[model samples]
Target: MQETLEFPDLLRLIDERSTAFLAAVAAAPSLDAMVPTCPEWTLFDLVEHMGTGRRSWAATVAAGPRATAKVEAEGAPAVPREREALLAWMAESTRQLLDALREAGPDRGCWVWWGDSQSPATCGAVARHQLQQFAVHTYDAQLTAGDPRPLTEDVALDGVEEFLVTCCATTSAWPHEPATIDYHATEGRSWRVRLSADGARIARLPATTTDEADATGTGTAGELVLAFYDRIPLDSLELAGDRLVFDRIVAWEPE
Candidate 1:
């Protein structure tokens, strides 16, 4: 895994990216515009989802481990029809989330649904999770506005590592036979992922290694991260080795 980012740094990123996301929402010509990346969601729905998600996470950080019930009860708020009002609401939600995270501090114990029992449920994990959420949704907002920008290299690389370690490892089923794939990001970070009927395992590879693998994907860090999450098409990547192996790996849906 890539080195854990400091909690304060993660909060800073959340602030920056959340601003960008709301800006895109503001620039959107129509709230009814469908987000191509998330076909089921219109721009209005996306904004509400992002804002309410931040509020729910903020509540989780404040309540700590005892917050699970509260988190579940806090559903997303209804999307506002007026454009300016929606933008204001988004800004307020972001500010509230940042305040909650700062108050909780890095090591403060908190409930995180994604964290395994062995992993410490702390404010840091919530911050990291929110950072990735902001990054991805910002891209979604931009894409909807028809001027998608790639994530920064550092954030994309960390996101790739996070997805493998967290999402892939927890997937419970594999439709195809076991296989291994190597992901080499143009940013010079790489990881080895082993997928089987049992589950998936991931390891960060030494930068200089040249070992062969059953399948390999070469792409920019942002492309790799987006592709891994099925946010972008697989053809966007440069594939070598066994294409089927790579396909099967990506095809697995997390339980």
Candidate 2:
């Protein structure tokens, strides 16, 4: 399994990306502008989700390791209707989350959705996943505001692994024909993912490989990660083999 990012580094990203997300929303032409990636959501809805999500996760982390409460029951405040108030809520929610994460530190046991995966149920796990949450939603915010930017290489690469570990490669059965797909990032990283009725497995490929796959996707790290998150089209990548396998794997979400 790939290592989780250093606790401090993950926290730093959470802060920076959340700030970027808020900045994007604050500068948006209109809060009502629809997000292209999330066809059903407006910029306002996106910000509200970000704010309340942070709030809910904060409560979960604060509950410590043995806690079993669902995140949705954390009593996060509803979004304020006013523009300034909504932005303020988002900012405060972020601050509280950061505070909670710092207090818990990296190894402290905490509630996390991916406890069964290689990632432990700890404050660090929450921080890692939340960083991706901010990173991806920031793109949503930027896209809504018409100022989208590519994710940093470090964030993008980490996100790709996180998505696979947390969202894919799960105990849940695949319930589809067996297939293998390869993802190659221009920066030299690669992952070979296998899916079967049993479940899914992912292996990090060597710097060079001769083995073939049912489907292959090649792109820069940013593009590959964004495509995995469905933030961008898979067609944007150089693809080979069964495109349907690529589509199914990308669309699969952990229950």
Badly placed stretches (over 4 Å) of model 2 are 72-78, 250-255
Candidate 1 — which residues are off by over 4 angstroms? 69-79, 115-120, 171-177
TM-score of each: 0.89, 0.90
Find the candidate with the highest lDDT and give its number: 2
Q: Write the residue-wise lDDT of candidate 1 on 88-139 in tens digits.
A: 8888888878998899898888876655322347887667777888999999
Lowest lDDT block of 10, candidate 2: 69-78
The local distance difference test score of model 1 is 0.80
lDDT of 2 by residue, 1-255 (tens): 565478899999999998899899988999999999998999988988888788888777877876886365255566898888998999999998999899999889887766556566778878888999999999999999999999988888888877776767666677688888888888778888878766787788886689899999999888987887888888999999988887687677755
Clashing pairs in 2: none
lDDT of each: 0.80, 0.83
What is the number of backbone collisions in each predicted candidate, taken in the order shown?
A: 0, 0
